[model samples]
Target: MKIGIIIPARNALPYLKEMLNSVQAQTRPAHAYIAEDRSTDDTHEWLRDHPDLYAGMRRNRRRLGWAGSLNAAAALALADGCDALFTASADDRLHPECIARCAAVLGADGGRDFVVPYAQQFGEAEHVQASLPDAGLDDLVRWPPLIDKALIRREVWEQVGGYSAKATPPGTFGTAEDWDWWIRVWKAGFTRYSVVETPLYFVRVHPGQLSDARAEHHAATVDLLAKLHPDLPWTAESRQWPPQHRTTRRQG
Candidate 1:
């Protein structure tokens, strides 16, 4: 499958170069694209000068937040005949085989909608949090065990109807948007498998990062989801299965 990586960026000048370098290091080199949301920094100029770094680039005159920017970039990749789409934030880094490993899992079982890879947190504290070894419908309804960056098939996107269309403002939905997306996919009967091994993506945590605000409007979004899908398993306790039961490993 032809995998395309979409990066939604705005004011990410500090780490854009290193992030692109990591993208270039992927074992199965993916076609990378950047949705350049309007930024006050030199992000646009840098992209313009280093146009060769990406397969294709789209610049938005105004900010589209995470959902909108991602939607735009995914649309471009899908239109270009990419079979699978993987999203990477400008601030994070991916392991060399991240794309290849994820592609193998999804391709192995056409029945699966997406593959959730393990993420290693850095900067603030060094730790690796493996997603639930395997997540079912109930797991997704409760929370998104997978990190934001994931490799997914075009068929899955078609089924879920894409990310939430936000008209309000960037970061308005906060981190709740990802939770909302997974909820819809689970409701559609799609299952997510966790690749429990070394980290696939190195997640960066620092002051003022937007991910820190995930809980900003989370309660409201959760309530909205509950009202929309009344049958979903709304649990007060954690339903995550222990990660020790997993045996899958990345193959050469």
Candidate 2:
């Protein structure tokens, strides 16, 4: 399968190079695309300077936010005839076998629609996170068992219509977008998924990141999700973190 990595970046200059370097170091040869979302830093210039780093790059006129930027970049990959798409954040790094392992599992299993890899949080915070071995619709609705870093089949993405661009408060963005997408994926009937035991994805945790805003808008985001899917039993308690899934401290 021709796997394509879509990296949505916004003011990610500090860790962008490291992330790209990890992409280049992948054991499997996968095409990489960058969606530069009107970054104030020199991200655009840097991407221009290193043409060999990625197969293609798209710079948005305005900030398209996380989901919007991902959709734009995924379009480029799909147009280029990529069979699979993996969305990676500009600040994160992938293990050398990340692509290879995911591609192997998908290629070997005809029934699997997507593959989720265990992830570790680094930088300012350190913890290892993994989804349930057999996560289903309820697991997704309750809490996002899988992160957005998973490798997804191109057809599944096309069928689900890509990630939702709508933010909770209309004009704002980047709150529970991945979680929303996962719920849509489940609702669309593409429920066959697998998990990679190894921590192949590394998410950087720091102050003043998008996650901080996601936490702030948790209540509103839950309300918006409830409105979006009234059929599902979304409660005020769902707004609070679930105890079922917990992160463990990363071992040295």
Candidate 3:
């Protein structure tokens, strides 16, 4: 397989069909592997019914959460000689040309370890509805562009091990993996590029989505990251925004 797109999922079958269609509709197709994470939903039945389209698909023997399950899928892809690997959620949708555009950008001469693209929360206006801004995050710490599963070279992963198995559980991550991965990529001296034109992923925003509703968990994770990496630039203030229109100033 030239590329492997691994989706880590648990109790997400309602969105599974749309996500699968997004992958099948990609201008550039790759090996699609779904890491079940021991779902209670009818995911296995879904996979069995759609077996022909998938290059490879499997389930976790036990519930391993996002990081560990995705790592397992990545390892399987590497063993199959995939050129690159990427992980997306089961609840997200991809633009029709998302994979094609990503391949083109990552395969360019810049030797980028990963490529990024503009992304917006689902069902929201593009221009003003941008998710939690840079806040106190350095201007350089912008949102990650979407990644292409087909262009990442395996060596880059070897240097920077796959997503941490020890990290907090899925419902608790609150978008923490993205930051952790970016930090690891930055520390490894990998070239990260961003595509300014369009967004490849349309992220769902619901009350149940891990990201939309985990303030305390997210805050705790940030503190955890700070302790894990003391020298991180925006230590207590890493990539988070306070409530909109809220002010924390002293009055005379």
Candidate 4:
């Protein structure tokens, strides 16, 4: 399937090189789009040189928040006739085979709407257990790798309309837009899965990573599960998925 990868970045110059290098390493190449948030630094200048890295690469001048910029990137990928779309954080790098594995999952699994794999936030290795709260303990916590550099079917994105662009409170109506989108797709009878063998992605994490703040706003999104996935039993067990479980539970 034809694939497009969309990266949403803001002031990620320090890590942009690593991100670009990983993108270049994807086993199956995809057209790349970088939604460069208005960076005070040289992020835009750095992006300008990326055209040489991927055919059909382009950068936008707008400063959409993570949610808005990602939506914009999806729109471009869809418009460009990509059969599937991939999402990546500008500061996080993907495994070399990330795209290929996600695509393979989408293609082989009777065409699911979402396909996710395990991701480990690099660095901060020492504080992983000490610093982070448990998903079970914090009702606000949503699982990480909540998405892969997921290769979404273009048609699925059209149905969901992507994320809400309206700005909101610090935590309100923001994070988990993708999770919200996935719940909607799943409720409509689409499938979702996690790769079995090894991790399909490696999320580079430092102080400013979006996921580093998961503890703060995860519950806000989790609270909406009932509305988003009307059919799934998003219970404590569901919230704390073990090993990996796939289901299309009919809602109560």
Query: Which candidate comes out best when scored by TM-score?
Result: 2
Candidate 1 structure quality by residue, lDDT tens digits, 1-252: 788888888889998888888888998978888888898898999999998788878898677777878888888888888887887888888888888888777777544567777877777655675666566666655456655667887888878877885422233623446667777777777765445466888887765553343343444455566666678766543222221223221110
lDDT of 3: 0.61
Q: Which ten residues in a row have the lowest lDDT in candidate 1?
A: 243-252
Over the stretch 118-222, how does candidate 2's per-residue lDDT look in tens digits? 888987676677766676766655567776788999999999999887644465757568878988998999888898889999989876552454544666677
lDDT, each prediction: 0.71, 0.81, 0.61, 0.59
Tens-digit lDDT string for candidate 3 (1-252): 277777887888788878888888888877677777777888777777888655677788887777777777777787777877766778877788777786787778865565554555664323212222222234223332223222355777767897775445335522455556656666777755544356567766655443344456556566666656566564334435442222111000
Q: What TM-scores do the predictions have?
A: 0.83, 0.92, 0.78, 0.72
Regions more than 4 Å wrong, model 4: 54-62, 126-145, 166-168, 171-174, 192-197, 208-216, 219-252
lDDT of 4 by residue, 1-252 (tens): 778778876788898778778878888987777777677888878778656654343455565676777887777777778888877777777788888777777777466665655555566432111111112112222343244346677877777677655322254435556555544554455544444344556666464553354543544445455444444445544344221222211010
Model 3: pairs clashing at backbone N, Cα or C within 3 Å: 116-145, 117-145, 117-146
- Model 2 is weakest, by summed lDDT over 10 consecutive residues, at 243-252
The stretch of ten residues in a row with the least summed lDDT in candidate 4 is 127-136
RMSD in Å for all candidates: 5.4, 3.0, 6.0, 7.0
* lDDT at residue 52 of model 2 (Cα atoms): 94
